[model samples]
Target: MAVITGGTRGIGLATARLLAAEGADVVLVSRNADEAVRVADDVARTTGRRVLGLAANTTDDAAVGAMADAVERDMGGAHILVNCAAEPAGQKAVPAPSEAQWASLASHMDTKVMGYLRCARALLPGMRRAGWGRIINVSGLGARRTGDVVGTIRNVAVVALAKNLADELAGTGIAVTTVHPGLTRTEKVDAMLEARAKAEGHSTAEVEASMTQNLLMGRLPTAEDVAQVIAFLASPLSVTVNGVAIDVGGGVRGSINY
Candidate 1:
């Protein structure tokens, strides 16, 4: 089974559905209990597989522990974890942010970086006991380039955290990896595209075209595209790839896949 944080919406939700379709029982972790339950039911119906939603604030230790306990009791145990919880990166594009800006950045770290750690710590004991597990931390392409300071720091931190976890658990049959998605076509991206189009006085199609021009594939990768990669990495098939970050960006310009 898989426990996917932030699984009520966007990439996390998509990943949960994909995993369920692939024959894995899934638990969708979210802060909103109602929304989580609603989406879980929808995904379970559509995929015809076992899927559940457990509400927990990832930043809260007691809440995370309770969620893990529920997962163990309801689904037997989590063999995979996909950490995708974080507040959306804000709109401020300041290269050199002020103190107030740093505070905003710090919130991202607290949620994206430390929140991931909380979930990992809570669920890892069960995984170690099972003697096989996969942890896929969702970072972003901002880790590869330098533009948004907050995005850079948060995403890079996730990569570092995943690598450390993977190495530390290397001999225990558990693999930890990170996936960096770039310009994925999700609801959030759609809203950003609409806003940019309005601001630029261009059609949404035009704005989308410009935004995707930098990608070698000439289009943004869909959420499912990224989700499939995560599901693969979360499965036994991912035994070979560990302690590394995999980019699912459809070949962003100047990106060297070493």
Candidate 2:
């Protein structure tokens, strides 16, 4: 079974759907109980697979623990964990950031960095008992580029956390990895495009074109595109690929990551 935090939308929801279609039961977790249950029912109906919607705030230790316990009791324990519960990044306006603006960094860290750790801690014992598991951290490309201080720090921290966990779990049949998705097409894209179009006095299509002009693929990846990579990493086929960051950005022009 797979437990996907932030599974009500975007990449998390996409991954849950894909995994369920592949015959694995799924638990969709989000802070909103109603939305979580609604989405889970929708996916379950579509895929004809068992899907449970769970409510928990990853930043709360007790809540995360309770979530894990509930999953074990309900689904017979989860063998896959996808940490995608962070707030959307790149929201901070950082032009000579004020002290007040700087304070938001801690909240980002608490959600993406420490929150990922908390979920992993709660689930690792069950994974160890099974002697096989997949832990995939849904980080972002902000870790590679600059400009977004909160995004960069929290994403980089996730990479570091995954690497350390991968090393610590070596020879234990559990793999931990991080995936960095660039500006992918998700539910938020339409509103974002509309706002950008209004700001620039251009058509939404034009604004979207400008955004993807530099991408080698000439288009933004859809949430499903990124989820395909996550599904692979969550599978036994990815046993040899651990502790590394995979970029699902559809290729950034003139920037090479070695």
lDDT of 2 by residue, 114-217 (tens): 99999999999999999999999999999998777677888999999999999999998999999999998888887788988999999987987889988998
TM-score for each predicted model, relative to the true structure: 0.94, 0.95
lDDT of each candidate versus the true structure: 0.89, 0.93
Candidate 2, run of 10 with poorest lDDT: 91-100
Query: Residue 87 of model 2: what lDDT?
Result: 82
Highest-lDDT candidate: 2
Among the numbered candidates, top TM-score falls to 2
Q: How many clashes show up in model 1?
A: 0
RMSD of each: 1.6, 1.5
